[model samples]
Target: MASSSAPSSAASTAETFPAGTPAAAQIFTTVLSQGPLTRLELARRAGLSAAAVTKAVRPLIEAGYLVEDADTEARPALGRPANLVRVDGGRALFLGLKLTGDQVFGVLTDLRCRTLLARHAPLSDRVPKAVLASTAEMVRELLTEADGYGVRVVGLGIAVSGDVDRAEGVVRYSPFLEWREVPLAELATAVTGLPATVDNDVRALTVAEQWFGAGVGLSDFAVVTVGAGVGCGLVVHGEVVAGAHGVAGEIGHVTVDPNGPPCHCGNRGCVEAIAADPAILARIREAGGAEADSIDEAVALARAGDAHAREAYSRAGEAIGRGIATVANLLGPERVVISGEGLAAYDLFADQIRSAFAAAAFGSAARCELETRPLPFEEWARGAAATAIQSFITEPNRP
Candidate 1:
């Protein structure tokens, strides 16, 4: 295992990844996610020849970044057998952070994206300066922790909500953070002395899913998060779709009802207007079934068998289902992974979501599987780390 306390210069060295060889990167990435593969399997997965796989694995093994494990079963009685190749998780370390409106959550992760430690601090203010200060403090604390492991921290990933331009690391507009046009990557790099990658939180999460979670091996999938807001991340043609304007899968703004409640986006009947946490809370209050001021209160009331609260959740689920159906209709994704904080109330409206989706789906579109997985805040931070990994590998040639 590489020591986390390695010199800063060593950390910088890891960032100098070899380029101009797509096959090498692809082979390494394949092993990183689904490793312990023989050379033949690596070639098959990476669509490369055995010679190409051998060439790619050579540098990685020489750098101590990948290891070959002997498989006793694969070894013949006397002859040698091919070894399985896998990435060395302990070879490097990374920092990932998720920036919410009121808090900054951070985590230290290994190359396998395993969380080693997590830290969080509340945000007293959402101003760019305040957020940057809080972020710097958080990074400092994590870096100190990294020092004990004797491994270099090579990169930092910051995940924020809203219109984030990952290519440029600019947050064009974030309603929750009340930020606009913030050059977050530059600011963060300046403060932390590490290369930084900033991305939309949902898209970052989607990348994590594509590499290591439910969306693995799937060319087309959608992740719909229901929580403080409704957000969607889409993958088409084996690539995350960021759209032309850096915003593509804003399913929260998908219109479900033309005459429904108004949204913060100044629209009516958006999915978020009906299904987000605040929307649920507002609906509960309007129904007068409970004196709830938040989603927790509403969930409690519904759990306690309050009919009005139950009705509110049902309506929200219907809206969410409709929004998901819109994504399915347009993209024809093979599967949709439903997640987010609002899944805490999944039982309250799961049926409604399924039924509404089934009803709204046109033709075979309903065949798209909808699976729910609850992702905690730490996972979001991990998604940020994945973005950092992506940048470390792809930055040199990114358009």
Candidate 2:
């Protein structure tokens, strides 16, 4: 099941999810993800009886979260045409924020997790206090824009890159921000006056993909993001695994080359130590004795046919491929999605990634499909909103 917290205080006055049982959450999620479904079709997809589906959907429809309409497109040939059911996207609004070391990205979304507006601000400081201030300002901007929609923004989700405890609304550690044990959700709620959820950025992105993007309908899959970090999010048996300690998919820290460069995690040759942007840049500088200030510069050098730069990217790809192979060999996911800002340099190392994976993967694991998707920062912010939507609907009412 998706990890979520109870609705925040800001949602107290808003119309809460009427049905609190897990069955109702499941039924509503089915319609939200794959909807306009007939009651029979919904029951079949959700693995629930027709009566259970009806029972679960009643309160949701009455609360205006789900709506029914005539099946004009595919009316039944039999007696009465079945009505199609879908989530009412405009019923409520949410806010999502993606926190990076140097910038903060935000998006406003409705109940269906559609990005209605996006805004971003630069971060001059990584201090938790400064970040909270920036987040509050960003929230204010989004809320101001949301005012035009005539809907209340009920919850806020903050996606940070590192270990996050979503249920507790805390940032256990965010390497990019150099933060440790930051009670981000509570602080964000205090500053922004909205309920908050905190989650790992890549995992949050996986939620968006699982519900609305590439991973939709896939029972078992992985989302491997390559950029400042090489992060993975695993969905096993149709549920995103948070693991026992909330660090299930730290594929970045997986050892790919024991003798390779050191990582911030104080390890040698971890995937992130080689495949991450900083690592790639470090490699370019070390190999060519040229200071490539940014990833763009490194990509440009490779694109211009610089041997050292191209070789650095190739090595990164190889490390990434090996890491992916490990995930496949262990979990045998049906598909592995390669995404993130690093995809901008994919052309430089695409072949190496493919060949390395092909060589390292064992037997049936090699059958796991590999595909690349380039999702922008705003899309990641929208993912934060998806978490808020999940929290709002799935969390049981508090005593």
Candidate 3:
């Protein structure tokens, strides 16, 4: 799970992503996400003329970022077989890191966001300097692995659970880590010598889902994560919502019961206060004088038919469900993805979650599909890589 070896000196230079113009970047993204498309289909999906797509793709293809090939499997009944275009996954590499309170999860991914390697380092300290050293060491290990593929690692992305200013590459606040005003991106870049991007962990996960996982091709959806802390990531009108102050979709802080429990954000009965892993454990301990050292232990106690443990899980589920309904009512998303390490105990609370969601959802909002996905910390790291890929292709258009 970890290594004590110090990081070597950083790489001097890296390759650049080829998409420069917004139109070109948009076209590349279309192919990267909804890829292996014919020129006609790419043009149609991108809402651009064939000539425009061709012009945009030319530079990308020349740069080895895009590849064209015959779709023998989908060879038409008509005269000619159409060539499908797709991103070249081996063209460039990126490093992504998910920083948690106790550990750092990292991954090496290609241009198309395919994970090639993964590593983690235990975090005994939460200070910026310590975390940065651990992060740099992890990136060094990953970059060494990348050397095998004969490709340059172009960027590094760090996903932290907090209010992150992606545009500014700063972590404004991180309650879990007790950090404030940390210039994470600059520090990371200085350590690794790669362009670094910092973003909210859940929002970074949403970006990965939008590009490659459950939320692909869906314009309106929400990703609600339950675990040590409850978090939500929202996508509306095909863009992740960052809000005016770099914080949004914070359903975890929504007050589900005005008198339930105290939240770290200074609110009573907030969803996270009742539904987060620590909260469930605390409730179980309070109800019957039982002690669960970890969420897994709490799950096992509930599964063993302990009444207090079961009741605690039920309460957590209800709080989470209400928070989800709030999101549905406000956004009317087409789907909501419920995920995180907490899903390991989903069976214990599944019914309560559904029942509460059904009762609280407003009108047509109740019609929204609810999906449960189990994504480990590694996937969250992959999400961080996706953010790096996004910045790489669209940096020119970024404000």
Best by lDDT: 3
TM-score of each candidate structure, all chains considered together: 0.94, 0.95, 0.95
For 1-399, candidate 3 gives per-residue lDDT tens digits of 134333333232445667767889999999999998999999999899999999999999999999999888887898778899999988888889999998999999988899889899899799998898888788888878778888778777889998999999999999889899999988888777788889999999999999988888899999999998999999999999989987799999999999998998999999999999999989998887467888898999999988999999999999999999999999999999999899999999999999999999999999999999999999999999999989988884332
lDDT of 1 by residue, 104-172 (tens): 999999888889999999988999988988888888788888888888888899999999998888999
lDDT of 2 by residue, 177-296 (tens): 999999988887767767788899989999988898898888899999999999999999999999999999888999989999999999999999999999999998888645689999
For model 1, state the Cα shift of residue 16 in Å: 1.9
User: Which regions in candidate 1 have their CA more than 4 angstroms from the true location?
Assistant: 1-14, 76-78, 396-399
lDDT (0-100) at residue 130 of candidate 2?
83
Let me know the TM-score candidate 1 reaches against the reference structure: 0.94
Give the Cα error of residue 16 in candidate 2, in Å. 1.6
Estimate every model's Cα lDDT from 0 to 1: 0.88, 0.88, 0.89
